[model samples]
Target: MENKQINIGIIGCGRIAQTRHIPEYASNKNANILGYFDFNKQRAEEIAKKYGGKVYESVEAMLADNDIDAVSVCVTNSAHASISIQALNAGKNVLCEKPMATSLEDSEAMVWAAKKNHKLLMIDQNQRFAKTHIRAKELLEKNTIGKALTFKSTFGHGGPETWSVDGGPNTWFFDKNKSKYGAIFDLGVHKIDLVQYLLNSAVNNVSARLTTLDKKDSTGKLIGVDDNAISIYELDNGVIGTVTSSWTYYGEEDNSTIVYGSEGIMKIYDDPTYSIVVIKKNGEKILYDIDQIQTNDNQTKSGVMDEFIDSLIEKRVPKSDAESVINSMRAVFASIESNETGKRVSISGTK
Candidate 1:
């Protein structure tokens, strides 16, 4: 907030930091990378070497730096809430990677921390900024899609080991203690957030099946976390649908989402050839050529970090602020419950 420039620090110099956060923040005039911190100091040092930031010896040291104004929490899923909460209580704005946390309670605590410190706590749900998805939401809101009914979404890619920094089968992404769940928590949340965003709905219940059908660790053993998940959700508005996430697509990555309504069926990311497609109830087809959706594999621009900085400077809450984060967190935890109990679990979309 000093001179409209926010000094930024990064907690986890892993793949996402390099692939998304560090580069994206570097391109913005208002956000400055003050330093980096990682359990592996060498990794942090390496990022600072190329990106122009000092390396912190520990999270405590980084948090104690009064010069730093904000921090990006891009560690594994499990560390998101803890780091973000610490940053917020340290009086620094926080832009945390998605899934909010492994559980709803952690996410709630994170929100509480943000409120207690009067600092920004934003979850980086960047798919909402995808041109196709943005256009899809506009159409839905304008009734270009009429009364929404149901939807189905799928997000998949080759396993994370390939992209994780110095990765192997033993990367933190596959560890249950570090990642919580594989494709479910990692990729599934992205698709689910887009679904709720476009539909303007909140999940009321979820039934899910999560599995590790094929992924294995270096010892050729199945990792404790899941590799695939399929969930059926019923939203408060009576819209019902299925969501799928997997680390075994083994083909071109699939991050497609389809929404159904009385007037039309809207499709997004369904075709590598098209950004969006819609078929009206009367059988008329419409197509939109917009920016392609960003994938971890793609370097297309992401507006998440920039948006966070802008919001902080303008004294406004970011688009992916705490309330939206908690709702998405509710949906995620419900799916986890459904998977564990093999029963449809209820989600309370209330405070």
Candidate 2:
């Protein structure tokens, strides 16, 4: 029921926790953020103090505390499976960040671990929660974009340096061992996931060309990870799409997705605002601006976290749960394979 507050714990007090999770959880009255755990004890303490919560030394300690109803694994890309699996086995529901895992085996294990423990496993693919994205998805489903033809989506920002509070080599975003596939995995995951989410389909095949173009560290040294990447995919629904993700953009935050259907075209962008533009076959264009739907802070779909809390209490599937995000992971891994082999990779058995 929505009458009681659910106890929540966060593992990995990194950029995600500091910016999104902490603020969102603190503002939501339905969830009680009991505390957080980070490898960096000082960072954990800082976040907990700021949120009126406590810091636990380890995930086990946090999970052992009976008050924690759920645990958010905000750790690195590689550790998502292990941390979430450990939390699930400990009888705590888990909400892990994107990419599920860097590889298929780990991703599947994370899913299986949740099933084995009968715990909820959610992937924090919050792009679908964006008002613009949700509105576009609705319009597509309503055939407002006509018989889905093809789509192009891209997410480009000025690298993770500006995005993270603590910049430089210290940031795990630059660690290949932790981050997996640079921009392709970091930013591409959202685009791939949103495509599947909006189309209600799985990528049937994928091909990619990856590059570490313009790689430069804080000191201007060459970095090992990729700075720009592109992937082409064919959805099971027969819709072909292209997804480009980069950490090399120099100006303006650009996250835009456009879909062209037999009847018209639909576009959604993040720069100007969270809004959707649809053009009908008759050449009539309609723009549904979500400026008013935005919260006082201009954060769109700030209610998604609340929705997750409500789903937990209602014993229902959360929007960002594994059942959906697994498809995104499939697309990511398949794209990686395509890049490595310089050929199209078929995503067989993917729904």
Candidate 3:
């Protein structure tokens, strides 16, 4: 069906759904947002009224509608797998927000459910689609900087308070029960996925330190999860790197990656004028003028929602498919374990 349009239902009417998923999907010619469901009925109704979709009182009600061929699971970190699995079992493709699930087991289950139901399962690891990152990946593939030796990738911001729909210290992001882990999952996962994608390798070992530095709840106590995290990773290809995530960056957001290679170094988003810069050992410098990476404040076409729609229409796996992202999730889990156990944690399998 070359002219087919995929019907979509959004599972949660949170900030991400409203800001990213809804707008992007609405812009895709082959995707239609037909329904919306949220824990708060009024919120769902509000979104439906503004976005031209039916409001379903419950997730089950939304999934039961056969007209919705796909659903975006934009809920809490803990609920991602369960809701996405439910949608998959109901014969709907799923586009789940990043940090796919709270646990590796849950992530695996979501992948399995999609395979069993023969539905597409795309993870919203939008970093892969960043124009700068895409160019960096191509350069790496071409050995533009020679074999990568080491790297550092970081994603930090003031906090999720201003970004979440309910802006406050007590936002669900700081709640361990709802978010499981804080910055490591919220910001770190994106870097982990991006580094792996850029290097075309899997992280096989991780050592981390996670700490709660500044965030406090309404009761004036530290939040239940870590606000800052730093991890050392060793990729299976013998490349070493450091990944850092934090909510304590009180100034401008810092989402940059620098890779040191045998020939020279490649910097992404580290320079104000150039999206990517390469300096060779021979003192030759190459610059690429690409679009800035998407941030919470400056929203852009993430290319995730569009990719999900195209995957459904083309009958192919998405660029950020469920199975492909498991390795990145594995690295995040390893980092957590390393922090808890005070030792280096090795990823269980080779990617």
Candidate of highest lDDT:
3
What lDDT score belongs to each candidate, Candidate 1 first? 0.87, 0.82, 0.92
lDDT, model 1, position 192: 82
Tens-digit lDDT track of model 2 for 188-234:
99899999999998998999988988757667776777788899999
* Candidate 1 stretches greater than 4 Å from native: 349-351
By the TM-score metric, which is better: model 1 or model 3?
3
The alpha-carbon root-mean-square deviation between model 1 and the true structure, to one decimal in Å, is: 1.3
Provide the TM-score for each candidate, comma-separated.
0.97, 0.93, 0.98
lDDT of 2 at 94: 86
Decreasing lDDT order of the candidates: 3, 1, 2
lDDT of 1: 0.87
Candidate 3, residues 1-351: lDDT per residue as tens digits? Answer: 368788999988889998899999988888889989888889989888898989887899988897988999998898999999999999989999989999999999999999999999999999999989999999999999999999999999999988988779889999999999999999999999999999999999999999998999999999999999999999988999999999999988999999999999999998877999999999999999998877888888888998888888888889999999999999999999999999999888766
Model 3 residue pairs with clashes: none
Give me the runs in candidate 2 sitting further than 4 Å from their true place: 1-3, 270-274, 291-301
By summed lDDT, which 10 consecutive residues of candidate 1 come out lowest? 342-351
**Which candidate number would show the highest TM-score if scored against the true structure?**
3
